[model samples]
Target: MSQDPPRIVIAGAGHAGGSAAAFLRQYGWKGAIVLVGEEPNAPYQRPPLSKAWLKGEATAESLALRPARFYAQQTIELRLGTRVGALDRTARQVTLSDGAVLGYDRLILALGARPRALPLPGAELAGVKALRGIADADALQAALGPGRRLAVIGGGYIGLEVAASARALGAEAVVIEREARVLARVAGHTLSAFLAAQHWAHGVEILTDAQVAAIEGEAGAARAVLLADGRRIPCDAVLVGIGAVPNSELAEAAGLDCAGGIVVDLAARSSDPAIYAIGDCTHRPLPLYGRSGRLESVPNAIEQAKQAAADICGRPPPSPEVPWFWSDQFDLRLQMAGLAFAAHEVVVRGTPDAPGFAVFHLDAEHRVLAVEAVNAPADFMAGRLLVAKQARVPPATLRDTTQPLRGITI
Candidate 1:
């Protein structure tokens, strides 16, 4: 008699989980694959939730990574609206929310992250929301309209994006950031200043170093935001976009090593060889920087998925790519490649007042550390290549836009 094929169970059917399934099949894995998700909808791209989707520029069907028929055609089992209650590491089994237990020869945890909630008073009031899923997007969209007011309680990407969308819908938008500058945590001062100015030019009020004491509401519906300085900003809705907390509870319960996120190796393997973690849920080492950190970008998710698939199939993983992220606000397209936090010098390639510009971050040795491109796709792409190759270039050449970026590489 022929032996039964091994079974692989994936938890969290988001980008990471869904991509892992598809890649596994592509890698010729004939095993029984099952993907379990807490959300009812199929896997969809999330970046659009705050921009295009919120602006009514994209449809629900257009957001899906793959059609429903694709899963059936690939013979991949999808358990939508299902949750994994617990993991039995010893037995290599997972108990579903409905009390059904499934065994797996290999397990992948792609349990992404959730929006961090504000613990302020009146936070639970209606009309106060956080955008994380499609449902949250729908709620926020309904609240945005002409003559309405939206107070965003963070200066992060989501908050800024939502503020832009609200403004586009003719709603008065205000961004309250506790830091000294908007995007202080992720972006450098140059990019931060540019974005702040962009929002201001678009008539969206931005208050940096502003603290929210509480969300004041009446009849359980948000009416205004109270600041630490005793000033009140009246609003019809409030969006809390402080950040996200990784959903690594299941991994922790399963006895996997976890810190800010589940600790995984470059191969996306956890402490246990049979188990792997990927996407925003894993804090893996960055070969480029020789440091370990958690990345919350779609490219990181897809790359990690491919790595996990390779590891599970006993194949060599693909070459590691430099980390990159993008944001769309108004007509500005911000693309950042690599981490700019530790750069010693920043070189501006184009005039910020113009329609296009790029910021290149370099170390003492003039090695390209990161690049922030505003409406400069060519610069962003070249910067990504240089960062991945660890190329060092002359600062003067980088600053000269008239010179071709590819020829100036050192």
Candidate 2:
């Protein structure tokens, strides 16, 4: 008798979940694939949500990762608007919010993350929102208008992006960050300086180290922002993008090892071999970073999903790939393809003031750790291979604009 095809269930049809399902089908997984999502619509890309979507440059229809017909054609079951509440490992069944149970031989937890709420007065006002979900985006979009004021409650990536978009729409943007510098949590000192300058040059009123005490509004709509320092700034809209918390409630309730996120191995498999996790909700070991930390990037989600899909098909063990990230801000296209923190000294190669240059970060031993380039995709690509091999290059040579970036490799 021939063995039956495996029944696979994937929770959260966002970046990682949807990609894994499509990948499994591409890998020739002749099995039943069920993708469960809490949202009412199909999976979509999130990178452009704050910029293009906010600026009316991209519509909701253009955001779809794959057409609805694609999933149908691939024979992948779509369980949109369905929430998976619990996982029963021993029984190999999942409990949903609607009290239905789904049995699966292999499970993928792509639960993703929930937006971090800014706890302050006026936060519950109608005009205050977070940008983690489609519903949140729609609410914020409806609140935007010409001559309106938009107060952003954080200075992180999402907040900065929103501030830029709001300003472009002719709305007054006031960014209140509790840190001494903008983007303090994610970037190093130099990068933070550059990003802050970028925002300031674009006419964003950035207030670092300012704590918002309350959100002031009338009739449940935001009107102004009150700081702990007793200063109130007039505004019509507010966006809180402090950070995000992993959506690991289902896994934690079911006794999965979770710390900040669902703990997973190199193959993106959770503590329970049968259940694998990926995306922002996972606290798996990242080999490329030379550390184990929760990475909340879209690239991390997609790559981990691809690896998990391969593993589900009984393929060879896949190790974590080189971590890569990018940010599309205004006319600047910043590209980073490896671990930026593994460096001690940074060499600025090319024109620094010209908005197009390559910054090479070297380790204590002077080995190529990472590279940050603006409008220099070629250097970033070559820098990835250099970091992978741990090359030791001369900082002075890297700074010279005359030589091709690749020729200056250590």
Determine which window of 10 residues in candidate 1 has minimal summed lDDT: 1-10
User: Cα lDDT of model 2 overall?
Assistant: 0.84
The list of candidate 2 runs beyond 4 A from truth reads 1-5, 408-410
Quote model 2's TM-score. 0.95
TM-score of each: 0.98, 0.95
State the lDDT of candidate 2 residue by residue for 187-219, as single tens digits: 666667777888888888999989889989998
All models: lDDT? 0.92, 0.84
Off by over 4 Å in 1: 1-3
Kindly list the per-residue Cα lDDT of model 1 for residues 19-60, writing each as its tens digit: 999999999898999999999998999999999999999998
Best-fitting candidate, measured by lDDT? 1
| Per-candidate clashes, comma-separated | 0, 2
